[model samples]
Target: MGLLDNMKARIGPAKEKVSHLAQRHGGTIGHGLERAAKLVDEKTKGKYSDKIQAGTGKAKEAMDRLAHRSGRSPEKGEAPQAGETPRSASPPSSPEGPPPVS
Candidate 1:
């Protein structure tokens, strides 16, 4: 197999393992990510706070994808609870046309 294919083959199992762990302990992982980011920010005295925040957001997004929701919707950066259906991206309907003057 090509190098890329070979690498993927080797990494497949590891990826599955990580995804499972993320699914099971997503919340804990998220909390750890947040705490780590906070500590790093404090140590840097907010010098790279923006970069840190961006990186942290990306990490949480990755964790969410790894968690693999089924039925209920999980909050951002969190795993779905047991027996919960995956939450749909349902938006509230716009009632009527325009809002009355308040």
Candidate 2:
């Protein structure tokens, strides 16, 4: 087989293994991401707040995907108990108007 094909064969299992690992340890991984983001934001004195926020969001998304792939719900079936906003109650940003024409 060609080098490229050989490499792909070798790496395929590794990729799946990593995905499984991510799913199994998704909670811990997500917690670590949050802690790291907090530390970085504190260290930067909130100077890079926007970038830090974006990174945290992306990390959460990755964790969600991993969790879902492993047959876990993003949120356990706890209804909007106490002071929680339901997903549908939130105001639409562009309810009446089309998106901006760019």
Candidate 3:
């Protein structure tokens, strides 16, 4: 097998194990992520606020996926809502149409 293939083969089991752990302890993991993000933001005085927010969002998304609680279906285009905007609606448009055809 190629090096990449061999590496993947070895890491597959570890990934599965991590998924299981995340599922079992997702709440704790999510809390830890929030706490860590808050501490980091405080330490940096919000200079990296955008990056910290993005990372926290990604971490929560991963935790949700691992816990199977994201409410997104592979076959469905819309995310399940708890005060979230629906995916079917277009975002707000400008009054002008198509920029006067260039």
Best by lDDT: 1
lDDT of 1 at 77: 59
Model 1: per-residue Cα lDDT over 1-102, one tens digit each: 899999978887777788888888999999999999999999999999999999998888878867774323357757545444446636788898788888
lDDT of 2 by residue, 1-102 (tens): 999999978877776676788878888988899899999999999999999989898778866655455533225554543333454555656657776788
| 87: Cα error in model 2, Å | 32
Task: Tell me which of candidates 1 and 2 scores higher on lDDT.
Answer: 1
- Clash pairs detected, candidate 1: 71-85, 71-86, 72-84, 72-85, 72-86, 72-87, 73-86, 73-87
Stretches of model 1 off by over 4 angstroms after superposition: 69-102
* TM-scores of all predicted structures: 0.59, 0.59, 0.57
Off by over 4 Å in 2: 66-102
Q: What lDDT score belongs to each candidate, Candidate 1 first?
A: 0.79, 0.72, 0.75
Which scores higher on lDDT, 2 or 3? 3
Candidate 2, residue 84: Cα displacement in angstroms equals 30
lDDT of 3 by residue, 65-85 (tens): 655643323345756434345
